[model samples]
Target: MAALTASQAPGVGLGGHDGKGADAAGDASPGDGSYDMELPPLESPNPPGGSAPGGVGDKSGIPKSVLAAYKKAAKSLATSTPGCGLRWELLAGIGKVESGHARGGAVDKEGTTLRPILGPVLNGAGFANIKDTDGGRWDGDTTYDRAVGPMQFIPSTWARWGADGNGDGRKDPNNVHDAALAAGKYLCADGRDLSAKADLDRAILSYNNSSEYLRTVLAWFEFYRKGTHAVPDSDIPPVSVPGLGEPGGGPVKGTPERGGKDGGKDDSATKPGKGSGGSRGNGDKEDGKDGGKGGGHDKPSPEPTAPHALERATDQNITAVAGETFAARPGVRAETAKGKSVKGVKVRFEIRGSTQATFEGGAKEATVTTGADGVATAPALAAGAKTGTFTIRATAVGKNLGTVDFKATVTAPQADKVTRTETTALVADKNGTFADIAVKATRKGKPLAGTTLTATLADTAKGPFFSVDQQGKQVRTPVTVETGPDGVARLSGLRADDKPGTYTLTLTAEGGAKVEVQLTIKG
Candidate 1:
């Protein structure tokens, strides 16, 4: 179930530098950390892509499974708490600084880390003293509790914020999906919107409560938001990261200068992967070009990113019934100018117009990153009680490519009961017609307008007949009339065959609704 083979994957452990890192601020337990965990090392070379979750901004970064977990967590919150506005990039930033994405995506296909990521023991020794809460269940320590899992949730904190993200019926901090969700819920608690700068900072600080940690995570977060591409979750390669000078005092492996837009990411203030997180490769050059392993080890330069265009992958026009799921989900593809699939483009699927329809988790808008296939499909959409036409627009972020719009139509619901507006009596007119009476169709008190109702006289031989037309020339025992905006269908033009007697008129509408109105005639 692992994204990469086990033999090739190394055991980097969780982010921690021998569990000796300390929180300089000396504040309360941030969230799930006793001591700062060492960042995972970035070692993936320019390898071929895989089918599982994969993508980085123009490079092979973040294991496919690990990336998927972050996105899934954010998507889950979008529905459970739309006000949170949790973005996958935010979670990714933290993950980058936490365990270097499970030591650079050394995770199984199900987003479970191959190893149990544990931090230093929290015995009040240069770290928060959090005693064992899980009885050594998570951290394998009975005396003290150390941060565990890819997101580094302490046992006590995990107990409260733990979530079943993968639907595996288990809440495991070692699983990236579970940890990402637990982390996301914690960040979104108290109705805080991460989109706001203040709230965003607060949430990050609550996780580690360190200004340096916050800055490191924010750097990664901002970089991810810019864009990413799917890289193979293979063994990490030997490359130099900016600020973490070469071990042999050799020139930095990265060909590009630091603090630039391309590879030398602008996360310059705090050196990443110091204690708990490890540094990813920082360079614009592809694979190996700085002559690392041996001479002639240089490879060709990376291809220039071509312009991309958005194409509709799913039905252009979709439909649904009120209070039902949409038949088909809207999907889009990002293709290069030469029609080749492009990876790492951010595609935003938005629900707009006059409808209360929401994607899974009650979210109207969701952003999905393009996977290896350059495809992004939105979450399942559900039409709420309100019915009308709406639009699902898919647009590629940072791309000049135009958007694709999916026209969604939600039809009216069936009526449950048909009742008479005036239950008193229907008086027959001497002028070959009956006084106008109305029957309404409703579903749980909500008016169901535009419903068709048929009126039929019980005894057609002697009772009044209905005028099917305005001229009264076309008459019949049963006539059909559609309800108006008030959900009431007007019944009129009841003519008798020169006979006077009390009769019953049966009105039937949608949803097996049948009502009887008494009609009295005197001759």
Candidate 2:
């Protein structure tokens, strides 16, 4: 049980590199791995202006192969588990936390770690007592199991969750693709939607079962949520920030420190010794603080006085202009199981799903404690430049009533003026694709970015149709394209009909600007 989260289970206390046993974490049902009952208010894990790997990612310091692996896993999971709402950012958050993107992108082109990044053995001495489940197959330890690979999955969990994400036929935890997809599957298990805080908390807790781990992973999750750019696959040496992404923000015992010139050599001291952060919260043999490291050890997190349930206290649906504040402040109420008002319980309000919106300080999430009347109101929400609908999730932290989702919409003030960038007539032979079709969208002579232009035939019939291959069949349908930084978007794959005739194609931008193109099909 220690290996498969016997000690890493939620409420098992802060495990993973800490020197402590399982501590009571609220009313978490042991290994059930859900915080729907948490009463703490939803808040951002990353504080505003928290120090990040300054130059690593996109300034996204993630290695190219690692980034590709994350994205590839996410994309594959979307098709397999669309309800999971898995995003690459979550994988990056775990990768960043688990092994700092394979120790600062020290992996080969196939996304395998240059050297084995192993954790201290779970020998029941100071760490979780997890016996070998992979027969020393993955962790190379036949006596006891160890958390292995970039995602730091122990053998038992890997046995159940391992997947061949890269489709290499063999499920290898050392491979970033397989490990990342496995992490996504583990997080999304049991129909969990990552957009919800309760589900997200449970997913993370099931991985490490520590409040500190939850907070750290959430911090990285939110930081990545803001933005992450792909870095080059160049041989950038590993440079881990202290207490940023690693265990307790320091080096684990038996592992090379971040930014250390360890030359990607294999770890000889794989077994964590007395003072290393190998044990779960049971630090070193001396004082149980940060496994003998300089930092303070993780103490048992204080459980919150939770509320029973949460309901919308204000309008659940809101609308505002792009880049403007909504008139209605999203709010929710906390109640007990008996429907009694619960006061002082924190309710966290967070932006969820697709949209660019934030509270003050560009914070995508916020926490508000319930008032005397049991109601918690969030601050005014300012919509970002992106125009679309999304949900604002409210969770009664530490309480398991699930979450309340509020719908919000942001509208653009005006439509850009869309004009044809290519004046050439769209002439195509029957069944031939119309090539070199392009459009530019601008507002007041300035190019617009992220402008949506939907291209369609004036008449669905008797006109050249946009043919696209779907599921091995060619289907005719209208297509939408978005403008880039330069405000230009292009189109292709428009096929001509057998009847050679003149037709008109229209490209309409979201804000109402429309441009017409003449299409001539030859027989």
RMSD of each: 18.9, 24.6
Candidate 1: which stretches are off by over 4 Å?
1-60, 234-523
Name the weakest run of 10 consecutive residues (lDDT summed) in model 1.
Answer: 1-10
CA lDDT of every candidate: 0.63, 0.63
Least accurate stretch of 10 residues (summed lDDT) in model 2? 29-38
| Model 1 Cα lDDT, one tens digit per residue, 1-523 | 1110010012221222222222232222323332223222244334335534233323336667788899999999999999999999898888766665665565556666544455555665445555656545455555666666678777777767789899864576777898999889888876678899978877777676556666667766776666665545533322222111122111222323322243332211121122111111122232444434431211212332443357777779998778878879999887642245678888899998989899989998999988888889999999998978989999876554557899999977778898877767776644467778788898778888888888787885665776545764546557788988888888765666566778788888865688888887767
**Clashes per model (N, Cα, C within 3 A):** 29, 36
Write the residue-wise lDDT of candidate 2 on 73-167 in tens digits: 99998999999888898888777766667655656666766545565556654455666555454555567766777787776777677788876
Model number with the top TM-score = 2
TM-score of model 2 (CA atoms): 0.40
TM-score (all chains, Cα) for each model: 0.39, 0.40
